[model samples]
Target: MRDPDAFYPGSRTREEWLAECAFDQACGGATITPGGAPLPGTEQAEQQPAEPAPAPAAPDPTTATIEDVAEFAPDPPQVVGEPDGIGVVGMPTNFVVDATEHTVTGDIFDIPVTVRFTPVSYVFDYGDGTRRETTSPGTSWQDLDVPQFTATDTSHSYGEPGEYEVGVTIRYAAEADAGGGWFPIAGLLELTAPTTVIRIVDVDTALVERTCAEDPSGPGC
Candidate 1:
């Protein structure tokens, strides 16, 4: 008869080899008996079925709405100029204004998001039936190195004397970021600043022969 020890390659005995083959069959692998015959259940164990993977998560519906994006809209712009009053009638009054860039960060539907706002254009309403639009925020006459009443991009002259309600509307553009590159929002937004009341009056000039220093408040001294 052929020797059973020659069928196995290792130095294990017959009983040890049988135990190893039984362990391999339990672990979903093929097994062979000491006599070189395949085990009855080894093939079925080796072909055990696999479990299906879990499905992916669904997207949030709130993040796709307009109201969600509008929540990140910028606040109203601040109007900068002489708060007390302005110059007299026919004078070149500079309507200076400025708007700084701002950022808002928060979560949208459990997803982190960031929004940025920047001023793009300025519309000035002088309250005298005249309106002007410009890219600059305008500067004072002294800053522009020019004399008063000189025509400038943002300077306006009051034709008559009265109280004018000066107001400005600022246009802002928005951009969004969600762990990716920045992209522009669908539409532009406009914000109007509080109206400013300024008094405009006509100045009268007089010429006198005597000096005003001696007369104190006499005549047009």
Candidate 2:
């Protein structure tokens, strides 16, 4: 067994000179208490309940779903049609759409979040009992360096003449940022713009003696 005096500083043998040095240099001449007993008031500080583990760190934005940002979804795309509200039978009438990415701030599961909606695709309803889906938002003939009525990917020829209601639906993919970088949300959100009314008319041609430009009131003018 170890000697008790060797373990206890007070009972251990010490030279007179060493004891004098320790008495003058240690504890600022105050009484010293040993052992693991915490200092007064330190016990309460150490038992402060650990700050609740930092509140579980609100969920990562990556876990967000499309439904979470549904309410903040972007508005429908802007639809523009060539010939501006009119078309000709057997002639292709073009269509175009415009959409921009936008962000909205709202709460998801009680966590503040910012969501961005980006247009991904366009579905055009020509209102002639036909629908076409395309990734390209049709460009105008002038922009394409092509003549008007020329058939393009987004242009459609009317089988008959009448008044038609044209419509477009835009598909939007969403991303969320909850104080962190953006992350893609699952699924897409679709929204439809107001319908545009178009009138289709049939054109008739006849041989004339003079051109319409030559004569102010020429035949078939």
Candidate 3:
């Protein structure tokens, strides 16, 4: 029948109370504290320590404001994509078996390259000769460490166990190719030719991290 805020001394809002004090029982269920004195068994209230707040989260992917484009952006990255942005030369076209815990690390570009930053989407041609597209990638550098970036395609996580190949293709912003041709830049980047990689099996993981340890047989392998 009394105000809920009148009882909780540390907070006023229901949200704050729910987050900080609801689980805590040191307050002795005191619905009210007249003259800041405990209504009843409030001795533990003074003895209890304040709970530490949770750590802040990493940046969110949604509802974040971003630059619409990188027009005339300085010192832009060199994009060594499929020559003309088709899928390119030596990418992880095929997959190889590795522990699921192992973080994949490899460079798939012939060299770093640059782009106009005017692209609707991109495709990645995994070396084994398969291609995948981003469907509709909204241009934004907010999600990546690099600037003036775009999402070509994402890697597939093997939910269970299986072999798979990977590839990508990047569709440019130009509706038509050079000289007003629909199939223009595709030929330039060799769109018809998707990059290639062989099949790779996902395996079980034991130790994702490693410490210094010499083989029992010798100093080093």
- The prediction achieving the highest lDDT against the true structure is 2
Query: What's the residue-level lDDT of 180 in candidate 3?
Result: 16
| lDDT of prediction 3 | 0.27
**TM-score for all predictions?**
0.62, 0.69, 0.24
Per-residue C-alpha lDDT of model 3 across residues 44-126, encoded as one tens digit per residue: 43343477644443321111111211222222122233212322122221111111111111111221122221223345444
Give one digit per residue, the lDDT tens place, for model 1 in 1-221.
44432223244443444334322322212123233323335433334347554443344322233345667766665554442366677777767776767789876667777776666667889889898877666776678887766778876889899888888887665555555444444344567888777777788878776678877787864
Q: What TM-score, to 2 decimals, does candidate 3 have?
A: 0.24
Candidate achieving higher lDDT, 1 or 3 = 1
lDDT of each: 0.59, 0.67, 0.27
Task: Using TM-score, rank the candidates from best to worst.
Answer: 2, 1, 3
Candidate 2, residues 14-102: lDDT per residue as tens digits? 23222332223221111112332233355343355655633333344454556777899876766777887688999998988777777
